[model samples]
Target: MDYRIPRGTYDILPENSGKWQYVKDVFRRVAESFGYFEITTPVFEMAELFERSSGENSDVVQKEMYRFMDQKGRSFALRPEGTAPVVRAYVENHMDKSGSRNKLYYMGPMFRYDRPQAGRYRQFYQYGIEFIGSNHPYYDAEVIAIEMAYLKALGLQNVRLEINSVGCASCAKEYDLALQDYYRQFLPELCPDCQKRYETKPRRLLDCKVKTCQVFRTDAPSQLDYLDEDCREHFTQVRAYLDASGIKYLVNPAIVRGLDYYTNTAFELIVDALGAQKSIAGGGRYNALISQIGGKDTPAIGFAGGFERLLLALEKESIPLPGITLPKVYCIAIGDEAQMSMLPILSKLRQSGIYADYNPDKTSFKAQMKAADSSRAEFAIILGEDELKQGDFILKNLMTSEQERLSAEDLLQRLTQ
Candidate 1:
C-alpha cells in the first residue's frame, strides 16, 4: 500500500524544532507583555461559525473551507482561520458576562484548502490575538505593534507596514455598488472569479492577483475616498497612535485584505524576502463580526502570521534562533559487564537533574567514544572492565581533553556541581 503524509503538510523534526520554539516563545512574551492572556478553542467548529463570520460569499467560505457532514449529518469544518473560531468561543462562553475586557491570544494550526505555496499550506500554524470589548483605535495600533514587535524580536530587519481603511458596513454598501458598476463594464474582460464577485462581492475585485484582473482594476474606486466621517476619524487616530509609538508605516489604499468582516482599519506586514507572497502578517477591525455570529455587539481587532513563513524570513536574513540543548554527559560502557554496571551510575546522574545518556547498543570503546563526540556531550565517562573492578571511572572533559579517575560518588558530585 502506498501511504505518505497528505500533501500540503510537513513535519517539524528534532533538528529544526528549536527554531519553532524560539518564534513561539517570542510571540507569547510579546503578547503577554501587552496584557493579553492565552485562549484556546477547538480545532473544529460548526461550519456556520465561519460561514457567518467570514461572509458566505467570501473566498474562505466559498472556496477554501474544509467542511464536511458528520455521522449525525451535522455540518462541521476544520477551522479555516483563527479569528472566527475565537469569536465563536467568546459568544458560546458568554465571556461578555464578566463585564471586563477580554484580551486573548491563540497559537495553533489553522486549516485551509488552497493551492499550497512556499509560505502557505492546507494545514499551517498561526499566532494571533483578539481584543474584544474595545473599539478604540489605539487597540488597532497596539495590535499592529504587537505583530511588529514579534517580527523585530525574530530579527527581521526589513518589514513594511501597509495600512488602509475599508470603511464601515454603511459606507461599504455604497462602495460595493460603485465597484459593481465600475467592473460591470469589463465583464467580458474579467476573470470568472471576478465575474462571480461582481454580483456577490464586488469589493473583492480590487484584491484579485490575476494580471488581467489587476490591470482591469487600475481605475477601480479606492475605499479611502468613500470612508464615512467616523471611519475616516478612526483611521486618523490609529495613524496618530502609531506615529506616537514611532512605528513607521505606509497608507496603502489598495489593501482590502481577504476577509469580509474588516472595517475602517486594515493593515498588512510585508517583507520582500518571500518574493510574491510577501505578507508576513495582516488583519483589521471587525466590529460587526461578533453580532453577525450571534454574539453581543462587541468590537474586536486582531492579526495572524504564519510561523513557517516567519522562520523562513529569519533564515533568509541569516538570523540565528534558539536550538535544543545537547546532552551534558555521554556515558560509555566498554563491555557487556561494564554496560550493565553503568546503568545505576547513569540513573543517579539523571535523577540528580544532569542530562546523561548511554548507548543501548553494547558497541566497542572506539565506536562509543565516536558516538559521544557526535552527541555533542561536554564530558564523556568511560566504564571499562578495569574501572568497574576498581570502583572508579575515567572522566574525560570532551572540550579540554582533561582526564581524571573518580569514584562513583565523586563522579556524581563533580557532574552535579
Candidate 2:
C-alpha cells in the first residue's frame, strides 16, 4: 500500500525547522519584552465556539473549518484560526474577573481545509496574540507595534503596514445598508460568493479578490467615511502611536478583515515577496467578541501570522535566520572497554553544559573518526584501551586539525569554555 502525506500538510524537517524556531524565538522575545504572556489552547474545540465567534458568514466558519462529529455525537473542529479559540478560553475560564487586561500570545499549528497553495496549507502554523479586556486605543497601537517590531527583528524587507477602521457596530450597520444599496444594483456583476456576501456580509464584497468583483467595487463605499466619532478618533490614535514609534503605515480603506468579530482598527503586515498571499500578519480590535461568545462585555484585539508563509517571506527576501548549531564534542570509543569508559564522560560533558555525542556501535577507528566529522563536532575525543589506561585522551580540534592529550576534567573544561 502506498501512503502519502495528506494533501495540504508538510513536514518541517531538521534542516528547515531551525528557521521556524528562530522566528518563534524572536516572536516570543518581542512579545515578552512588551509584557505579553503566553496562552495555549487545544488544537480541537467544540465547533460551536468557532461558529459563534467567527460568525456564520465568515470564510473560516463557512468554509475551511475541519468539522467532525466525535464518537460521543459531539461536534468538534480543528481550529482554523487563533483568536476565536483564545477568546473561548478566556470566557470559559472566567479570565475577565481578573480585572486587568490579558495580553496573551500563542504559537502553534492551526488546521484549515484550505486549497493548498504555495504559502497556505491544511495544517499550518501560526504565531499570534490576543489583547483582551482593554478598550483603550493605545492597546490597539501596542498590539500593532508588537507585530511590527517582530517583523523588523526578523530583518524582513519591503514589508508594508496597512491600517483601517471597519468602524463600530453602529456605524458599520449604516455602512452595511449603504453597501447593500450600492451593490444591489451590481449584484449580477459580482461573483456568486460576493453576491451572497451582499446579503450576508456586505463589507466582504469590497475585500473580494475576483477580477469581475473588482470591476464593480471601484467606487464601493469606504468604511472610513461611515466611522462614528469615537471609532474615527480611535483609528486616528492608533495611527498616531504608530507614527510616534516611527512605524511606517498606510491607511487603507478597503481592508475589511476576513472576520465578523472585528471592529475598529484593522491592520495587516504585507510583504510583496510572497506573491498574492502577501499578508504576513494581520488582526484588529474585536470589542464585542467576549460578550458574543457568552462572557461579560470585554474589549479585545490581536494579530496572527502563518509560520509557513512567514518563513517563505523571509526566504524570498533572502533574510538569514539563526541556524542550528553542531555538537561541541563527539566521543570516539575504539573498543568495548573504551566504549564503557566513554559513556560516562559523554554524560558528564552534557551535564556540565557541553553538547556531546558518541557512536555506540562496534566500528573501526577510521569509521569512528568519520562519524565524528559527520556529527559536525568542533572537537573529537578519542578513547582507546591505551588512553583509558593512561588516565587521559587525545582531543583533536576538528576545525584546526590540532591534537592534544588531555584528562577528562581538562577536556570538559576546555570544551565548556
Candidate 3:
C-alpha cells in the first residue's frame, strides 16, 4: 500500500512552514502599505467562468484544467490562475459600476493538471493583486512597482522585467488572422503541439519552450508592430510611468499572455537562475473579460506570483528565516505538588502577555534545563516544594546564570516591567 501524497501535491512540514509564514507576512504588510484591500474567492469556480476568460485555445482551458462534474452534473473547475476568478467576482456583483473603485490582493492555491516539475506544480500557491475599474496605464506601473518592492524586500535581486502589449480585441482580431497565416507557412515543420496552436491560437506558438519550435517563431509576426493606435498609446504610457518611477524594464513583443481575455500592458518578471521554467510571476490587463462574463465593460489589470517558485528563490539566494521562538520565561516544576501549584502562576503570566511554557511532566532538573536552553528563554523559573512554601521561586537568568530569590508578586512585577 503506497500511502503517499498525490503527485503534484506536497505536505508543508514544520521545517518549511516557517518560511511560508515569513513570505506571507511580508506580503500582507506590503499590500496593506500600498492600500490594496484583501479579497478572496472560492478555490473553484463555475467551469464556464474560466472557459470564457481563458479562451478555448489556451492550454488552461484546452488541456490543463482540473474540471469535474458535481452530483447534479453542474461543472466546476479548480482555478488554474487567480485573476479570472477575481474578475468574475468583480463583475457579477457590479463592483466596477459605481463611483468608487477596487484594489484587491489575494493569496491562495490554484490547480493545473500539467506535468509537474521543479518550480511548477499541479497544485500550487499564488499571491496576487488586481486593480479593477480603471484603464489608467499608471495603475499598471504602480502594481509592477509594488511587486518589485516585495521581491526586493525578500532580498531577490537582478530580476528581469519583460514588458509587452497584445493589443485590444479590435486589433487582436486583425493580428490573430495575420498570425494564423504566418504559422501556416511553417505548418509542416512545426512540432505537433505548435501545429495545433497554429490552427486554433497562433499567438501560443510564441510560448513554445521547445528549441526547435522557438527557432521558427523568431521570424513570426511581432504583435507590437501591429498594435492598434489605442493599445500603442496605453503601452507607451505604461512604460513612461515605469520610467518616472525608476522601474527598470525591457520591452519584449513576444509576451502575449496565455489567456484570450488579456489585453494591453502585459509583463513578466523572471529569474534566469530559476532554471528552464523561469518566470516567478507575470500578468497583464484584461478589458473584455467582464463583458464576456455577464457584466458591463470594465477594465482591469493584475499579477500573480508562485509560492513554490518564491521558496525556491529564497533557497537559491540563501535567505534565512528566524523561525525559532525566544520565550520570555521557561518554567520547570519538580514534584507533583509543585507542578500542580505552578498552574495559577503560569495562568497569571499568560494573562500578563508573557510568553511562558512549562512542562507538566515534572521532569528531572537536567532534562528541564536542556528544554529551557532549546527554548532560548531569557529566564528560567524553577519551582520545587521548598520554593513553593517560601513564597518564592528560583529565578535564574539563563544568559547570566545570576540567582535570585524574590516574592512571586515582586518577580511578576519585575518581569512585566
Q: Report per-prediction Cα RMSD to one decimal.
A: 2.0, 1.6, 2.0
lDDT of 3 by residue, 1-417 (tens): 869888989988876777898999888888778889888999999998888877765678989999999999999999998888888777766676565448889999999998988777889999999998889999999999889889988888757999999988777778888888887777888889888877777788888988888887778889988888888998899999999999999998888776777898888999888988789999888777778877787788889998888778777888886565568999888878888777887888999999998876638888888898888899998887789888788888999999798788877887888
In lDDT terms, which candidate is top? Answer: 1
Q: Give the per-residue lDDT digits (tens) of candidate 2, residues 185-264.
A: 88888899888888887888887889889887779888899988999888888888788888889989988866666899
**For model 2, what is the alpha-carbon lDDT of residue 191?**
92
**Decoy 2 TM-score against native:** 0.96
| Model 3 score (lDDT) | 0.85
For model 3, the run of ten residues with the poorest summed lDDT: 92-101
TM-score list, all predictions: 0.94, 0.96, 0.94
Give the count of colliding residue pairs in each prediction: 0, 0, 0
- Lowest summed-lDDT stretch of 10 residues in model 1? 255-264
- Candidate 2: Cα lDDT at 309: 82
All models: lDDT? 0.88, 0.87, 0.85
Is 1 or 2 the stronger prediction by TM-score?
Answer: 2
Maximum-TM-score candidate: 2
What's the alpha carbon RMSD for model 1?
2.0
Clashing pairs in 2: none
